[model samples]
Target: MDRQDAESAVRVLSGYPTEEEVAALIAVLAVVGQAARAAPGPEAAGARPGRIPAAAFAAGYQSPTSWQAS
Candidate 1:
């Protein structure tokens, strides 16, 4: 690995910030990262409901509607 990458993961682009400020930022980032990983994700938002085809109805498939109501 490159010397810079191995030494540090953060870089200063502008004014120098105190060590406490960097520590706080890193803590917040770590909490948010953990929350995101534990989440059920976008796919778990809800059921992927879709309209039943006319042919399915002809074959006696029950329609779905009650769940769509807000």
Candidate 2:
């Protein structure tokens, strides 16, 4: 957004922040906006968990078993 939009939005929020504070807030907001655009979407991040392949338990396979005390 342009300077005008930023200024107008700031006017709506409570408190009377100084010019420096406003500038800092805008700078942080700009970084966050940029990061959000660059980052991957939620769907892309929700990957399914992987399971062991069937071959892992195929014939002659010796899967580790817990030690028995009996």
Candidate 3:
């Protein structure tokens, strides 16, 4: 959406936002949505019952094997 449209939506959704702040907030929201969608299923499940970590967080931080040189 354009600057004018985002600003109007922000006003209705929350309150009036300045031009610069509105633009930045829109960009931030986009990134947040992207990350949420890209997150792994278990990691995104949060504190729901019956869920447990399959691996330690430290062990989970692995480089993309597909990108490594053979």
* Cα RMSD, each candidate: 14.9, 13.7, 11.1
lDDT of 3 by residue, 3-62 (tens): 988766777578766777778778999999999888776536665556444454357644
Candidate 1: segments with Cα more than 4 A from true spot: 1-15, 46-70
Quantify all predictions' global Cα lDDT against the true fold: 0.64, 0.68, 0.69
lDDT of 3 at 60: 65
Q: Which structure among the candidates has the greatest TM-score?
A: 2
Off by over 4 Å in 2: 1-14, 45-70
lDDT of 1 at 28: 88
Structural similarity to truth (TM-score) of each candidate: 0.40, 0.41, 0.38
Q: In angstroms, how far off is 38's CA in candidate 2?
A: 0.6
Clashes of 3: 0
Q: Please give the range of 10 consecutive residues that has the lowest summed lDDT in model 3.
A: 48-57
Per-residue CA lDDT of model 1 for 13-64, tens digit only, reads 3445557657866898999999999988644754344645566679976645
How would you order the candidates by lDDT, starting with the best? 3, 2, 1
**Cα shift from native, residue 39, model 3 (Å):** 0.2
